[model samples]
Target: MDAGAGRIGRALGPGRRRRERPEVTLTNYEAVYDFYGPGRRRDGFTHPLLTFVGALYAPEVRIRPETVTELHRLHDAGVGIIVAANHPSHHDPFVLASAVYDRRVRFLASGTGLTKDPLFRGPLRPVFEYTGTVPVFRAKNYEGTERAVHDAAAARLIGLCVDRLTAGGVVLTFVEGTNSSADDLRTLRLDSVKKGVGQMVRGVRDTGGRVAVLPIGIVYRGRELAKLPPRRPVVSAGPLALWEDPGPAPSVDEVRHAVRAGIDDALTDAWG
Candidate 1:
């Protein structure tokens, strides 16, 4: 009974995911990962090995160096950058990270998927953490719990990290919060912008650091992965949204529109 499962079992009634576990047995995931021994199939927990393999085998499945150069230029600007992008596929984070190569960027990930899967919980979870992914807890919590147990104050905490790296670094946020189904803009799903971006902006201002947002749009030539290798993905980097005020962040709609437009341009130029 890991703390999370125990918490879930106690709170979600008798017949739930945790009910499958024996009454007294606990889920010691660290031990499970140790037993499994890091393997190539598990990309979530395996760290350096997995990262190296992913880069080697999928070298062609990456962002272009030109895109990376533009990203570096934004870093050279000395403003904190929040990469608000659309999630068109499962490899979205990899696409973003490949372009960001070597930059100190952190990703705010949805906690639901990573924590729930046995595979991720066991052999592949470290890769998730090592890549600067701090999962955001979105589940509704039991009484007396202010926020979801897994994600309380996550946004605030990540905001602080952004502040600490204020001079230059990337904070990748999928404005939709999930993968979009089509080229058209999807409804922004993370709710309206919360205090996270605002807190980061204030921290940067107080420290005399600058803050900006880069809307990076990624488009798959054929969206469908079952298709041939003829369709290479394209990423478009838009102009930065430099913060002029230390107040609330841009609404999700605003970021979505910007990213969509950028992707449109990038896709048109890449294959046309």
Candidate 2:
């Protein structure tokens, strides 16, 4: 086995077979690197680069500054939190990160976005590293070259790094797992949710870690939350509810409802 294969073998274990997805073509590696590489290094500086760009480039979106201001307020109140929100658009991550800028939370992401040749990886991976962003491996299913990368991640358990992030501090996750074009939220693939978040919450419960799950709502009214024609964004933060001790790990339904509820409440207030 090569170095990468050796890595994944240890982390993900030997039981599962690798699967392939046509939608996720690897040929666009250059395109991905060109676009996402530089931003990775700039992720931590000055209000998260994307948020600043969105605000400047898409000023018409119109999200009240007060929404983020409220998030800061909660941070000041001393809450160790994990924020879960709906991923309606590509910009959702930036908008969500901006909402909690005052808190300085780390993000957990899929490894597929970061793995690459060293020349490209160096500049592109640091922002993820700086912000405590850890990667979850998605390459375990391939029998050939992809399997090699999967094995690398599995060996390091970089995919399981969410457990470490949750143990260390707050980590944000997009429970939906992927971005959606429609405003209507999709069903949480309970299995995916279980693997990432369930493991985090369960780990804390089994051992000991300060984990507070918080539901946040971002209301992008009118053209505020657009990714295509770029628009101004409006975001709202909801009051947090902590899960009880030994409380069951939140189900996909539970989390979705909470997040959706928060979003609904936020939209109501922002529009009204």
Candidate 3:
């Protein structure tokens, strides 16, 4: 592997796969499903869009130097990076975006929230796919939606993410599957990682790609209950587990639990 200079390749290259249907918005769920396939869209706009996103959130958070270094290290190695992070608030996407502004990153977004939540149906609707966010279906989606629909959508979404990482991209996801809704921001439930992380790891390995997991802790003070807003929240990347050649394939459940442990340990250490 050409593990070198990850900081050098932040711009989007040609033939980026994800896209949106400007003609038919997310409200038209049928159109969305049709338009949301692999290699269907382009990233001609993501670089600049990310620049704006990073700048917008820069003032709200302080990314740790070591975390930035870790990102660069993983990218330089030219290996797929899966960032399993905590979800404290909706603002996390912005904060995390700002932290990894220099890397080719994608956020795993919630299809359920987008399709079901009234707030996202407006201007925010486009935001889901605008900045390279990957929408995923889960059992947690809209009521009455068939399990088969989510199953099919999730399978396709996972394939798309695997392809992106196979091409040596960085993907960030909240391990808890959704925001913690915690009373404060000091601690998080890292043990509660969703199923995607393990799926990604196995997919990368199965598809002839090297992958690694980074346990990142979002640390800050002064949330809604405090005297100030999160003027200097921190995104700290640490306690990583790089790709290793396991003699034989491990079950998805095993990979999931191992990742959970790594993330939980990292978060616990950071929280203290």
By lDDT, who's the top model here?
3
| Worst 10 contiguous positions by lDDT, candidate 1 | 106-115
lDDT of each: 0.46, 0.45, 0.57
Instruction: Give the range of the ten consecutive residues with the poorest summed lDDT in model 3.
Output: 108-117
* Residue 102 C-alpha lDDT in model 2: 33
Cα deviation at 130, candidate 1, in Å, is 2.3
Clashes of each: 7, 16, 3
Model 1 residue runs over 4 Å out of place are 1-74, 102-120, 140-154, 165-167, 183-208, 224-231, 244-272
Name the candidate, 1 or 3, with the larger lDDT value: 3
Per-prediction TM-score to the true structure, in the order listed: 0.53, 0.51, 0.69
Residue 78 lDDT in candidate 2: 41
- Model 1, 197-219: lDDT tens per residue? 44545556556666666655666
Q: Indicate whether candidate 1 or candidate 2 has the larger TM-score.
A: 1
lDDT for 190 in candidate 2 is 34
State the displacement of the C-alpha of residue 126, model 3, in Å, after optimal TM-score superposition. 3.8
- The 10-residue segment with the lowest total lDDT in model 2: 108-117
Residue 227 C-alpha lDDT in model 2: 50
